[model samples]
Target: MKLAWLRSLESAHQDCVWACTWVPATDRSGGLLLTGSLDETVKLWNPEDLSVVRTNTGHCLGVVSVAAHPSGRIAASASMDSFIRVFDVESNNTIATLEAPPSEVWQMQFDPRGTTLAVAGGSSASVKLWDTAEWKLVSTLSIPRPEGAKPSDKGSSKKFVLSVAWSPSGRQLACGSMDGSISVFDVQRAKFLHHLEGHTMPVRSLAYSPLDPRVLVSGSDDECIHMYDAEGKTLFSSMSGHSSWVLSVDVSPDGAAIASGSSDRTVRLWDPKMRAAVQTMTNHTDQVWGVKFEAVGGGARGSLLASVSDDKSISLYNYS
Candidate 1:
């Protein structure tokens, strides 16, 4: 494994950077990096030098999630205000605004085919799907209440969804919740299939391995990263080393390793099989909130990892 510091941007935002995703390359542009933050802005960055390309502002509260469309020309962001904003990537024009009352929004993703946008509905214990073309509410995949549960019990909020991911094949959806439960859904049927169990704290971030639809990874406040066999319904491995809450985790595009940012103020590179942190980056002075590997193609080899922290900084690294 090889790593090199690329660039660091001080004051990337006034607060925590909550989410990051790689925008696929397009004819009119090279690839871009999209990030959402507690500053209430979704920013587009030129990946080459990590320069600010544009800042899309509209969300009334902290922007918690940002996802790029598979086509690269569109993106969506959701805020704590329970609203999802779909926008044009190049022009920064709002395409549509979606909401589900009594439910807060956390993480979101655009389907691999770009046909739908999935938003994790916090408190509502469901995932909301929006039609990409018509920009209309498409479906609500709700987690069924546990057996013998009371309607007024606070346990309902335990299903507060916090993160969502789409498999590379676009056939499935997996969402992590505050209660540490992960729900897998059948996208074609818009149905909640089953739950994956492991963590006991809030699961803040999750991702599916690009090479295997059955493999899923998650980061949680429990300071552990979990590897699950989604199809097998079994926990494959658990990685623990971060001194604080693990805020986010992302698999390299090649699926060779995993990268994670944590409240421990460090970014870690892990070997999935070893289930141990192979490297630690301690350049950030505060809690690290987001980490992602740049997508494949775009004239780039190896991989690029971007990390944002409570230190109000963004740091880029070259992974080889």
Candidate 2:
């Protein structure tokens, strides 16, 4: 697979852009890109030309994560203030405002079937699930503390969850934490299955291969990306090239390549088979915050990848 720089929008937001997701196409509109920033606003863009479609405001603090429902009709954005806003993608109408206090929200994702939304609960050391139909809190998958740690032990906070991802089949969920361990859980049983350990620093991002449910990829503050057998609980390989923290990582829809954004100010595309970076794009002058592949749909739009950075810019690329 190869990536060709397509376009970029400078100053897309007033501050650092931290999160982005693809809003699938609907009958009334084609697929659009949604991005959130430290500026406290979420903006929708027409990828065809990287033009602004709409800007959503009212987020209290820097937006930490953004997720799109499978139906393409709605999307959710979460901020550092611990609030989640679920709204209509087209009309921008508010659907629901969700929060689980004392459980700060970090990353969020909707299940493949769109029945539930899973959020990474920081400090609480758990993953919170919300029923989409009623927008009600359904379950909390708390991480098990270490054997010698007490419930009130200060070291337990080291497991503060930072990112969450769902397996393609939606049967399993994985959450990454500040201490670098990843907790895998069985969604149907709502039980913790196992923990995958390798990185020594905070794991800031996680993504499961869309084509392989067992293959999971993670980026960490240690400046490396590790691929794991999600179901088998084994480390497949580790790739290191970034000079600074790897902020975000995403597997291509075709699963042929993995893309990562790093604080080193570059976006690197990796060949998972070779376990090495094949190319790096260095257009952004600051830390890269997020990278995402467009989830395929019935529309004829070609394969696309997007990256946002602390430089207040969004870059688009054609992936083939």
Candidate 3:
């Protein structure tokens, strides 16, 4: 299998595009592409022609993450300023604005059921979950501090969270931190389960396999991609090829393959069964920041992959 380049938008964003997601097709509209950039704007695009449908401007700092509700009627975007704006997709009207003081926001995701939002709480050393109905701070799944640490180290910087992922069942949440620790939490009980460890540097991105909730994939600044059995708390395999930090990673819709983008300026496709990188695409000039698989209603769109980078562009590919 290979990634066939379909098209690319040069300067899709005025500055670095940090995050991207597909707003699933609802009765009112088809699947649309949502992207957040260092330009401080969130832009929605048509999948057919790559034309801008809307440009949302409110974030004062670079938007760090964007997540769409499963129903596609609502979406949320978070910026470096620790604010999350939950808005209506078609009307562009604000549903709610959420912020946890002193806790910087990084990656965010709506639960598969769309009833809760899980946010990576940087510096706060926790995963913040907000309920959708009332948009209230429902739970804080804080990462446990290291053993033997001093009492003075409360809110320790070593565990600052940078990425999070909800299992397909929505019963569990995993968060990656600055200290290369990934914490697993039981969502139902709001309990900390365990940590999966290996990478020595920060882990910046994570995803759970759609086919198996226990299978998790992560990319780290240590230049490695790891597959883990999250429930068993074990690392299955580690693939290394990128010469720099592996910035982003995602499992394909079928859960048979993994795709990753890295600071090494390349996008790679890896086969979990082979435990090796099968293909690499040199499509960006600078560091690649985000890589995502379009998970719209199965047959409406082909297997598609989107990658954003420090090069200020977006590239779409056919994952066949």
Q: Best by lDDT, which number?
A: 2
For each of the candidates, the C-alpha root-mean-square deviation to the true structure, in angstroms, is 1.9, 1.8, 1.6
TM-score of each: 0.94, 0.96, 0.96
lDDT winner between 1 and 3, please give it: 3
lDDT of 3 at 249: 98
lDDT of 1 at 26: 93
Candidate 3: residue pairs that collide:
none
Give candidate 3's error at residue 166 in angstroms. 0.2
Residue-level lDDT tens digits of model 2 in 220-279: 999999999988889989999999999999999888999999999999999988989999
C-alpha lDDT of residue 23 in model 3: 90
All candidates in order of TM-score, best leading? 3, 2, 1
> Which of candidates 1 and 3 is the stronger one according to TM-score?
3
Query: Which regions of candidate 2 are displaced past 4 Å?
Result: 146-155, 297-302
lDDT of 1 by residue, 254-296 (tens): 7879999999999999999778989999999998888989866
